[model samples]
Target: MVDLRRARTTPTDRPSDASGKGTRDYRHSWIVRGHWRNQYYRSRGDHRPIWIADHLAGPGDKPLIGGERVNVLRR
Candidate 1:
């Protein structure tokens, strides 16, 4: 998995997946490891969550984000 804990800087574009899939987010999440927690901001009864990518059967199979793969295509 990508190391988002090192995401002290905001990224304008996302990095490529091992399969070449690209991630998208106006605002990206941090902490690729550690707690598997994400950083999100909410406003006026609305909520927006930042996300990360993890392989289900891969080494990091915690699935804390579950199904919310690409923040854009995720629901």
Candidate 2:
């Protein structure tokens, strides 16, 4: 289970460059054992509290999303 959250130290800058991954790279990421959710909050250099996912790894009967795919990322 990959969980993505907004980075506390970096702010999204939409007007600076053409590449869109600036926000993605700085954003916090976590992989644990259910569902993926997106959210944001105000921060001032502090550790964000993370919760353990109960159903992180998808059910064995189906192929998991984002399990394996080449990510053509740009800097």
Candidate 3:
């Protein structure tokens, strides 16, 4: 069971430099056990509850349906 709500925090700038992750380091990541892949999120800093998907990792099997907002579907 992957904890989609659990976020891993890193320095916001770590992704932008030579590391090449470029903004990707600051975002949070979630792994789907069933899909065997990862999902990512970035901070909107809108002072509201929102999460932006950094990028989609898999096919239809893994998708962040709502842009900037992750809707976790539980079956």
Candidate 1 error regions (>4 Å):
1-13, 26-75
* Per-residue lDDT over 1-75 for candidate 3, one digit per residue giving the tens place of the 0 to 100 score: 577675788665553566665544213334333322333334643344344445544344443333354678898
Candidate 1: worst-modelled 10 consecutive residues by lDDT:
26-35
Taken over the whole model, the C-alpha lDDT of each candidate is 0.47, 0.48, 0.46
- Residue 48 C-alpha lDDT in model 3: 40
- Cα lDDT tens digits, model 2, 1-75, are 465997677544544547644433222333354444443446745555555465534345554454554566565
Which portions of model 3 miss their true places by more than 4 Å? 1-15, 25-31, 36-75
Poorest stretch of ten by lDDT in candidate 2: 22-31
Error of 2 at 28 (Å): 26
Give residue 53's lDDT in candidate 3 (0 to 100).
40
Candidate 1 lDDT: 0.47
Of 1 and 3, which scores higher on lDDT?
1
TM-score of each: 0.16, 0.19, 0.17
